[model samples]
Target chain A: MFPGKYQAVHAAALTVVLLALAASGVQAFIFSDPGSLYTAAIPDSWIYQAYHSTDQLAVFYGEGDWDLLYFEGLGKVADQSVRELAERSLALYGEPGGLSGFQLETPLLPVEVGGLQGLACAYTYQDERGNLLWEYRIFLLLPDGEGFSIALGSNGPWVKNNPPVLEEVLKKWQWTD
Target chain B: MAVDRLRKLSAWVIVLLFFSVIAAPVQASAASSGKAGAARFERALGGGAVPEILKQYGGEYVLPLGQRLWVEEVFRRLVGAAERQDVEYTLTVLNSAELNAFALPGGYVFITRGLVNAIGRDEAKLAAVLGHEIAHIEEKHGMNAVLRQMGLTVLLEVGMLAVDFASADLLRLAGTTLLELISRGWGREAEFEADLVGQTLAVRAGFDGSGAVSLLDGVLNLDSEDLPMKVFRTHPDTQERRERLEANLASFWPPPAAVDDPQVLERLNGGRILAQAGRNDPRGRYIVSLQENGAGLHIFDLQLGESALWLEGASVRDFAWSPQGQYLAVTLDEVSGDAVWICDRWGHVKRQIDLGRRRASQLSWSPEGKQLALLISDSGSQGILVTYAEADALVPMAADLGVEYSTWLEDGLFIFTGDAWYCISPPPVVPVTVQNPVPQVLQRQRILSPTVIKEGSTIRLTRPSLTMP
Candidate 1:
């Protein structure tokens, strides 16, 4: 009787391990592309789409009013410091009264992405209909003199509701090249 | 036992149903929210006006019309004076302190307040700056530059797509090409051509053609450590350009006359304004002249000796000093017509070459100071006429509708034009029939800034030259 019990327990443990492996594989399949210049692990519930072209490569994920855009090879800036480039990147957002009232939520701070030094900041703005929106941005300088940027935006209330998910997404971002 | 198991399964099914009911609304709300966010983002990027976009990027400045009245007036006068009037021009004064001026498609010209203030009170210099931007518009140099950048075939294909579908990406590509042109600057040849056209337009509009030189001088005076300045980076070789301007001043316009009228002399002497001075004159005295309220040329010695009225009852457009500084070639704009006067150091008219009806331009004195080459134009027909101080006749050299610009070669053997250098052997005697000689092609490539320099017996040109047979 004890022998059979031991066998039963072993089989159950193997099944659980297999299920965990399948879940992780499904997540990787949905979120990551090894052939791309960069990849990120997105939440399973979000929709993912990739845009590829000679000039630009981008990945966009959306769920409800929360959206994230990861851009690689976004063109070049005149030889300038990465900090200045980050400031310029912030200017791409439409100003107040149209789509967003641009306000700095967090000052630019040093961060590391893909083992390369970069800058990260958070900003808040009002949408066209006066809804409070927030965005987190990361700017990285590539070795090839090109720049990479990431923008994660969502309604203020949604971001407040899902802090852990947002942090996980940010943590999972990786640069392949 | 079967009843107990069925009861447990029924309880589990109820729990699943309860969770689905709670989560369905949340998923639906998220989908709707995502759609809305996407729409908002697309609208934001796609619908903003260019001016607003430019503002967001700190690319423009808001200057009141009152503050820019003078600039606007000068710009309007230049636009009215230009030969091409197909497009109405709008001028904007950027708020930045950078010394830059540029033109956009649809006849929009932008000049920084720094450039304007730096130019200050010198209307003619302002005209030179504006005229350059206008020439870029008139010649469509910007478009040509973009075409060169994007390749003609590819640009044309994208242009078709832009027109047919109004595709934003194609339009954006075109816009990017234009921005690059502005940032990188037009080719050196294009820049030189614009300079020529600009000075011509300024002179035609009754502004001093030398203002271009002065403007460049001001640009060179700017702090170079400000490396972010677009003018310096985009415009290469400022020193070379200044040298070219000096050469052009000597080759094209007449030297400034020496003003001698008592009132004009008093004003100039009191203000210490030496309008024109010969470089390294042996006598240690300079020739100074001033226009008497835009009507007469009053030439005198800056040493305060005696004042003499050089030419009365006529407006002087330009004047130039001979290489030896003995004679002054004065171009007068008269009520009757334009005339070139050769005056001595004493402000006496030694000889007069009346260019009847045909406007006289680009008076160049030969190295020996014996022959003066005059470019004469009438009703769009242009020809070169060589004049001698000893003789009253004009020797016709080369006349063609295609002659855009001409300069006297150092040896006095040829006149260099944009396409070819025409060999003009002076007539053996005065009052001889005009001889047309075949032009020797010095440069097979298109010459942009064809500057002819005479170093001893060697003739050096700005562009590459072929062996002259």
Candidate 2:
């Protein structure tokens, strides 16, 4: 094809793509930790926070904790197998503290992420203020009693709708050594 | 003789008519006095007024067993400190959160839960409150209002003080009239006198004189919009009261050095971190856990002036340093479950206490650091469980109290069952019924054994053997 004809076709395609993107109303951006630990494409509409003065790599993506995605490097409080950790976590949440309205939505299930084995579960509960919250937690075991966890919290419908942000983050994760 | 008899009859008619005319207005005045009339009649009749007062004020609020004992203990101490030779004071904690503190002529003192919460765990401030009410009684500030309002003068003047003049209507009229008068508070002079006398009483009761000053400061610092104590309009002049108390304290021969800890403010600041100083530490090193990044529980040993991130990756709910500052017990909420892991200052896990099937809500250190008191609960059972700090020994200390609050008690630990204070340490070896003390200041203070409470909500604290004075 001639150069002028090719330019005409390309501009038309670009315009259609831009219009489709505008219509979708979903936007995401790549987030990389300042320490160059890892990076992931996260929803731009959700809040993304990183606590710099922390030993654990605690990061949050949510609306002021009410609805959000959270990631943390939970240091070893106990030396246990991945299955043992999963069981204990389930039990921990099932019991009462400030959470009086706690219920298990789904049993723990083994899953694989980033070439590592981990456990994931979904649950529903009311916080101290009695705001009904739905949460999905994933715990990944690391070497030397170290573990990594990611929590996603929102209303039940959003959580049950396969939380798009969690799927996107998992799909776009980029770890740097 | 007939003429003399006629003269005598006429004289008898005149005397009878004279007394009737004089008594009619006095009776009308007494009748129109309303609740004051009812209260006066009740007082003269010599039945209890506390029940009537409580009935009007939403009944009595039964604090947890352990807390009730603590209040009673405070009342007893205040009584002994004041050295009153007569007039037994009944301390009744009315079930209102209106920040009211008032006294009745019958040595009855009432304080609201709102005032108690405002005081926090400061017993000295609580004494300051009680002492103020005591002053109202001591100075007969409320009594003058009581007599004029309750029509006691009417009865006294007519010489009907011993008459059974109270009707059902009079009894119904007793509460709100007196309640309204007390809630409005005594006049300016009476309040100032109460403040001065109350401070002295609290100081004599072994509390630091600064408690009154601190309490006043707290009131002044309250949100200007909500302005807690100011709602009663009693201490609306918070700044003025503080200045007056401070000046009076300066006049004291030797001012008290009792200063309140400013840590509750820290606790109230979103509670993002758990920071606490050791009970018996001389160096005043505080251990704080930072949740930033879930990086780990960093033991910030501010004593060495070093911020150390010793532990990592554990979700910490709460933690307490041992008495000797030798051991730190941190409650962890982890995927492996909620557990209390005891660590040393050197970052070593000494003991991991996981109460299977039961959750440990609070951990308090013994003064000696030899043991730790854990407020543990399950779906059905709630109590204080004492465990050897470094040992694997777990002893059920008190199964009678724990509605999810706990604190330290001089040589032992006190746990709140939300409604009662239960002693957890020393295990109460001697169980004594000790005839329920209807201590003055607590006119309607009823010590109901958990078994006596028929309420399904409160019956859970069945400490059949738990008897505390």
Give the per-residue lDDT digits (tens) of candidate 1, residues A1-177: 999999999999999999998766434333445346666666575554432212354444454434544444544555366687776545534321112466777778887776778887777765435656666667777777666665566655344333544555656767665
Chain A TM-score of model 2 versus the true structure?
Answer: 0.75
Runs with alpha carbons beyond 4 Å of true place in candidate 2: A1-177, B1-49, B148-180, B228-231, B254-469
- Model 2: what TM-score? 0.35
The window of 10 residues in a row where model 1 chain B has the poorest summed lDDT is B434-443
Chain B, TM-score, each prediction? 0.43, 0.44
- Candidate 2 lDDT over residue span B1-469, tens digit each: 9999999887656545533543454454554545454445534322345777687678777653335656766777777767545556778877888776777754788888777666666676787788888887777676555444555445556766432234443333334455556656666777888888988877776665566776765666567687545334854466676677766653333211221235532332333222343422333655566566664666556646667665676777766777677777777666656677888755578778776667786677767666677777777777766665533445564564434555554535554444444443342211111122211100101233444444311234442221111
DockQ for every model, please.
0.00, 0.01
Misplaced by over 4 Å in model 1 are A1-177, B1-67, B153-169, B221-223, B226-228, B246-469
**Distance from true location, Cα of B380 in model 2, Å:** 71
**lDDT of the candidates, in the order given:** 0.57, 0.60
Question: lDDT (0-100) at residue B24 of candidate 1?
Answer: 46
